[model samples]
Target chain A: MDLRDPALYAPAGHGDAAVLLALRDPATGALAFPRTPYGIGASGTPAEAAEPVELSGRATLLVCVTVHQPLSPGMQVPLVVARLRLEEGLVIDGVLEGTEEPPPGSAMQAVLVMQGERRACRFRLVGGAA
Target chain B: MSGLASMRPVRVVGIGMHPYQFPSETPYVHLGLTALRGALADAGLAWPDITFAAIGTGAIGMAAGRVMLRHLGSTGLEVVQVENASASGSSAFRTACLMVASGQHEIALALGVDKFGSAQRAANKDGVPRLTPEAEIPAVKFAMMARAWRDRFGLTREDLARVAVKNHGNAARNPYAQFRKPRTLEQVLAANPVAGDLTSLQCTPRGDGAAAAIVASEEAIRRHGLDRRRAVRVLSSVSSSEHQVADEGWSLVEMVQRSGLAALEAAGLGMAEIDIIELHDAFTIEEIVYAEALGLCPLGEGAAQLRAGQWDIGGGRCAVNPSGGLLGMGHPIGPTGIGQVTEIVRQLRGEAEGRHHPGARTALAHMIGLGSVAVGHVLQRD
Candidate 1:
């Protein structure tokens, strides 16, 4: 994943579904979305993980990247995206399902960013005194 | 063969639903069988009379349709499973109705059931594409859409509040619904926001439940001496999903008008003929967005309709959700679509004592699920 792409711009209250056509370079642990197809709104959530996943055509990817608030919990619950690869594939991406948030504590603000109508927007994930 | 879209005058003989709560004692199969038993009893039919069965559910791994039926003594008849996002149950019912109406089957049963499994477990590697999130959680993304609607339509807090108030009143009378308690508009505005402007009541709660319905053709109904009064005719059934457009060039209201037009056409009726509607109200804002989409009201005019008590049960031109809907009732995934169908059946039959639509002869059940998909089924009492 590009560490500096507009997708990483996390703000609270902003989110949706987008089909990201990504090619993962195994050697570098890098992911890139050359094309994206987003729906009117998100039908489901998406996530990526520490595991290496090869992308096929335009794999569905979720990139909440959590907005940490002083009261909000941190990035403990990993997001998940499925049906990623178009053809040949390996190693699942994103966090496992049913992964709950970690214990509360001091929290930094977390902003979630996703592709929007014209461009990208940001919002903070409020609530939680972690 | 003309598919389900061509069939007509589909009648529901039996209907059943499991409560919207976790089943502590029943296995998934047992839950389904029990619902089947209830439906058979409701329809006054025997298991052997059922010529076909369709099951809608998301959690069951494979042959979900056949396994659940076998437990209930379902003969090795045609059994199909429907997996249309959250509308799985309703899709199954529609399939059965098509079969019976097309003369492919004499009697058919559609049962929808689901257990509370992982929210988003890995999906089947079907050829069909699944909606992958690009950069937001489901709640956040939906909230964004709500925000966009507010931004575009200039909806006010009262506009959203009307939906909560309307659904809560509907929910108050639903016995099997997850949340029967009522809420006022003031309480809704004061509730906490899950994302953007989405308060707690705006989103559907997750629960566990199952529901089933039996549909038969006019010939079969007459031959079997079924209760004609309780028979609910299937006017039309239509399903569509996101065509993968950037923003769906047309507005939500227009899309629903497209779907509503097809449904009304298939039923040989008009929107004005629809007495009560169980359209998708997964979120409070969705009611605002989708009511317009379904052509229940004009563009940017849903709040005014609610303000005028148009969507209320006893109000004029009732487009309703007395089962609390996904909002107050708790959406148990698969069962929701069937739950909506169940509500329509009850309303048409005048069996819903506390939450009846008051002499509704024609009713509609509309549901939208994952994939930006939508399904509409029209029903009328004999």
Candidate 2:
């Protein structure tokens, strides 16, 4: 899916569908997480004009830093941020999921999760199971 | 030889700065004039002696260079303004250096002025549109890089915290530094966290300030009968934009590597010959990353070098950020690059009282702007 297309963004009150689409691979019947998106071709843009690609295989995640921002009013902690290179060619940034405090460069799987009121892509430690 | 080396020698005859502080009702004129006058006085020259001027600022638009410089009596000399993100002031200094080195002008002034707190936030509608779903802010990008550095090099939180400790300590001695309080490793660790492992003390606080430098050709110095003993020669200056990196948020690493090497080559010196350094430590993690990129150590070995006390003042090794750095020195965007140059000039001139690096003969100043760009300058006392 072209990221710039309005369709890539979930319709109002359709957060669930957005989460599902973010995690499901259209090229295959199985589940997969969308990797970093970017534009290609003559009009290559960043996230919006980029091609749609999912993690073709397991990817390693490196959690960079976590800081609390005003999601509502007060501050929140453990807002884990990370970078992952997909089996394809895209390297993207996302939130890291889970509370176990995975070591840096830990193997992780991208998953759809809720960040405040919005659906966001995050990574979860694979526990050598991916 | 680099273009700068092939041209006539340019020397920094004077440097000045307004103490960095939180934005207040004060105008940019006061900030700019204060630094400019200080620079003129430091150089023992008058405003009429300036043949050209270059002003660097990130925000505060509308002919900013002319507006502030007019207060100093515009001799109708060329006044150019530059904005290169965090490297704004460094870029300005480079421009002034080139003008002098190329013999385009005999005497030039590079001034940087900024006041963000009193300014209005302009929408980012003009630049490249955000293409990623995630907001790739500096904190986010650096946080991720910190993680990658850790995974690749075994750098830990404690190792990073030491940078804040050292820089804050240096800032405590700098009257011009916005943050004058020294921090301990425990204090740094105890502060509120920002990005991955970065804390409030580890991140730079954007404040309001200005810095200025007067550069002159050898002919100008001779004609004006200026004190040659104190003039710091600009051996090399190099500016570069982000290159394709191994991954996103790693532009700083790549850009610094490219520009730093070019700068050293231009200066005709090795990294070991540099006595002191001032770099864009916008975050503590950057100090580690840049140290490695600047060839002070191998990739992933900065943490070890930090622990070995190699970068400390009077530690018999090159001092990093003796002027406190962006972290503790106060990063007022435009003034940051000039501020780094100010510190280097002072150190090389033996004017950095209380925080002097003993026997310092050569210094390097580095700054980076995210999205991203890097600027490097090598200066020598001889």
* TM-scores vs. true structure, each candidate: 0.74, 0.86
Error of 1 at B349 (Å): 1.3
Question: For this target, which candidate reaches the highest DockQ against the unseen true structure?
Answer: 2
What share of the reference contacts survives in each candidate?
Answer: 0.00, 0.39
Docking class of 2: acceptable
Model 2 per-residue lDDT at B131: 25
* Residue-level lDDT tens digits of model 1 in A1-130: 2222333222222233222234344444344333123211122212232222323222222222221111124332233222112223221222212323222121212222323333332222224423
Residues B1-382 of candidate 1 have per-residue lDDT tens digits of 1224565457889988777774354567866777788889998899989989888888766787776676656476888878787888878887888788778898998988888765453334323232333323555555545655665677776788678877877787888787787888888887775655667777677667888899988888888898988888787888766542222233344555566666777777777788887777777877777767666778788888888888788787665676777886667777788888888889888898887777688987888776556777888886
